[model samples]
Target: MPELYERIAERFGELILNCPPDRWEDPSPCPGWTAWDVVAHVISNHRRAIAGLDGSGYSAPGRGEDLPRAWDAASEAIKAALRDPVKARTLLGEEFGSMPFEEFVRRMACADTLIHGWDLARATGQDEGLDSEAVAVATEILLPEDRDIRMPQAFGAKVPSAADADARTRLLNFLGRQV
Candidate 1:
């Protein structure tokens, strides 16, 4: 799972690097957030994960017009944290109370990274489709039997999809995306 997280993080970084500067202000599936905002949010989340895993304090980076650089720094921090097996087993607090660091990386960090990678690609007109393995893992972790019960609060209502919708589409719908 750590290796998987690393791969997902690398893919997300690639997507961020490929995003055109002109499209940074374009709206994304996330309500009221621009493509740049999506990247910023992912970077922020990565910081939170790093803080939780390593007991380091998080200071939000200045994303503004320097989103790519900020993302690169955050990505490097997250990858570095994940490389330490001893630190990866540390118990985190709050929402991650006592959860192993590696588990948090798999369940929260990696999942968010992959999903937002898709969101960033879609927002920038770079929707070449999500990786199949990542989509499968996201679906399994994020969409449990009681997902509908919690969907409205976290993601709003599930958007309807065609009967033949692929796993990626289904995963998007589950995340309150219209794709």
Candidate 2:
């Protein structure tokens, strides 16, 4: 079975693949970002993680490559990195502050993908439900570090949600997402 991060990436990839070509330019939940920008951001996140492994930064989509293909290339690279024992053990820098690559990828990358996956789905009028296990894991991992994640450059301020809201809703609300 695929690990949570891989599964989350795969789920996100499915959304990118199924998206109608015309919808690529549609504005997504992220203010001022298009559906294509969402994919590029996810790929950029992957490149950041990859940089920890080998100092390579974000590579924009090639002239012949669409967003989906670019996403596929990024997804495969990150998965391969995590699968390699040596690469998974590499240390992250900067915002991650020297955490092992696997831990950062599992918690941070996985959560990023999970939330952005919902953004894409919502923007494109697809199913917005997220994986229950991924949601639970994200809640468990992020809720404790609430203050750290609440900065304007990151998830920013929380949006209100009913106390009775489900796990996913609460996570979304906490991550500065209205839904």
Candidate 3:
């Protein structure tokens, strides 16, 4: 039984590892973000969350850096933090309030990674299918914040989805992805 963040991050990481080098600069579903930019955003978010857990200062992944290497290093640090009971349970700040670092990562970071995985896939011509379980969990967690999610964030305004669309499609639409 993997943690939610682990399961979601696994899919995102797989996409990263398989991304074509030539496609790294290709535009993604995320406006203004290339495929490489999507990966960097995920890595940066992971570093921010774990920074709160372990006091490891946050820094954006540099464009000149090897993003895959940086991503792997951050992933290893995050895994170590998650395994430590004290750090995992420690409170991390958010706009609303504070929750355990594990909860924050599982809820917010998990969803971000899952969605960005889709963006990366769309950009690089890889499979766009998402982990069904991750999509379900993300839908449940994100649906309630529909308005806030639309407000000039990484996500755009909520886009309409077909009534018959599947959970993953609905989730993507709710997060403002046109599917």
Candidate 4:
């Protein structure tokens, strides 16, 4: 079975490789974030999570509330950090002490990569689809948490109870995003 973490990383790499720098500045689905801003946030997340994987409480540098520059710098930093052992880890975990590094990485990366991909696609008018494993992993990770119902920002949308529904849509809905 393909590891969801690796799949998520591959998707991130694909986005970086395929998305143009000009597209980075475009607006995203996120209410206030541009495509570049989302990229920055994703990069920062990878960097920080990798730090935690290394057993260091990695902290993301302030984006300074400046969207464009912050996004650009964060993208650059994430790419750069992947080359360092201290910043890159094959394994990952959460800072909130919620779950194992592997499990946390699966859910976090899936949510970030898939949702942000949607944001980027919406902004650039590109086709955005998540990997099947990512969708499945995200759905499985979310179903029992009840966090989706408790936290409006994280998970507020209603997930369909249909058994034959698409996993990606289910994950998105579970995360409170309208598909």
Candidate 5:
């Protein structure tokens, strides 16, 4: 799972670097959010995970031309935090009460990174599909029985996909993305 986190982070870094400057303002699948806003949202989630691990509040740095550098720094910080077994084991929030550190990293941090990586990729016209392993892991961890209830708030209503859709397409459709 730690490896998965690293892979997702690396892929996201690539997507960020590959994004054209002019496309930052392009609209994404996330309602009104732009491509840049999707990146910011990913950064925010990483900051929140770090804060949860350390019991410290985290805020995103101001958006600027140096956003890539800032994002890389935040991404590295998150990877580093996940590497520390002791810190990773610390219980930090109510939603994840009693869940072990590694589980939280796998289910929360990595899942968000994977999903949002797809979001950013799609927004930037870089959609080349997602890692199959990551999709499988996400399907197991993120898609709970009550997902139908919770997803509508964070994602659009589920879009239809082929009966034999691939894992990536299934994930995207399940998350309310019309891939």
Candidate 6:
């Protein structure tokens, strides 16, 4: 079976490709951010992670108002980095810092992409679907025992807990998202 991170990366990419350009103008679940803004955030994350892999410092240059262009730039940079052979395996901070290059890439880029995919869907009034295997992997990766709670404080609210929820729900909740 493919690793969870790989599956998530694939699913996230699919979500991005399928997003309707018209809906990019709509507001998403993320407060004060439009669908385009969310996409920009995801793409920016990809760019930063790829930069880390390339031995360059991560950069999250804020995109003031032109979020669509920001998204396009970040996305293209990340896509190019994905084709590179470098691996970023250092732990600069508490997030996925200690993970392997590929795993770090997935946890940071792919999982966020999955969540933002939901944000975009909500903004666009479309169905939200995460790759089941990817969610499961993320759930395991973000278990409370292994979780660093501080990270979500900087990103967004953690995923809310659900009784009898599957791995996906648990993972989403752990990440401070409401599923």
* Per-model TM-score versus the true fold: 0.88, 0.89, 0.93, 0.66, 0.89, 0.66
For residue 33, model 2's alpha carbon misses the true position, in angstroms, by 1.0
| Best-first order by TM-score | 3, 5, 2, 1, 6, 4
How many backbone clashes does every candidate have?
0, 0, 0, 1, 0, 9
Q: Could you tell me which 10 consecutive residues in candidate 6 have the lowest summed lDDT?
A: 87-96
lDDT over C-alpha atoms for residue 146 of model 5: 33
Question: Which tens-of-lDDT digit does each residue in 13-92 have in candidate 3?
Answer: 78898998899999999888899989998898888887777666889888898887888888777777889889878887
Kindly list the per-residue Cα lDDT of model 4 for residues 1-179, writing each as its tens digit.
22455555656556655677577677776656777677666766765655665565544445455444444554454444454544344444334355544444555666676677666766766667888867776666567876544553344546464677677766666665566
Query: What is the TM-score (0 to 1) of candidate 4?
Result: 0.66
**Stretch of 10 with least lDDT, candidate 3:** 1-10
The TM-score that candidate 5 achieves is 0.89
Best model number under TM-score? 3
User: How much RMSD separates candidate 2 from the native structure?
Assistant: 2.2
Better candidate number, 1 or 6, judged by TM-score: 1
Residue 168 deviation, candidate 1, in Å?
0.9
Top candidate, metric lDDT? 2
Greater TM-score among 1 and 5 belongs to 5
Candidate 1 residue pairs in clash (backbone atoms < 3 Å): none
Q: Candidate 3: which stretches are off by over 4 Å? A: 94-96
Superior by lDDT: candidate 1 or candidate 6: 1
* TM-score, candidate number 3: 0.93
Give per-residue CA lDDT, model 6, range 1-179, as digits (tens).
Answer: 22444455555555556677677678877767887777777766776665655556655546464554555565556545445545333343344365555566566654577777777777876777777766665555556544445453234556567688876666666655666
Better of 1 and 2 by TM-score: 2
Task: Itemize residue pairs with steric clashes in candidate 6.
Answer: 91-97, 157-176, 158-175, 158-176, 158-177, 159-173, 159-175, 159-176, 159-177
User: What tens digits encode model 2's per-residue C-alpha lDDT throughout 1-179?
Assistant: 13888789888989998998888879988878788878788888787778767876656554356777778878888889888988888887876778888888878554788888998998898899898899998998898999888665477588999979998999999888888
Q: Report, for every candidate in turn, its global Cα lDDT versus the true structure.
A: 0.77, 0.82, 0.81, 0.59, 0.77, 0.61
Off by over 4 Å in 4: 55-94, 148-156, 159-165
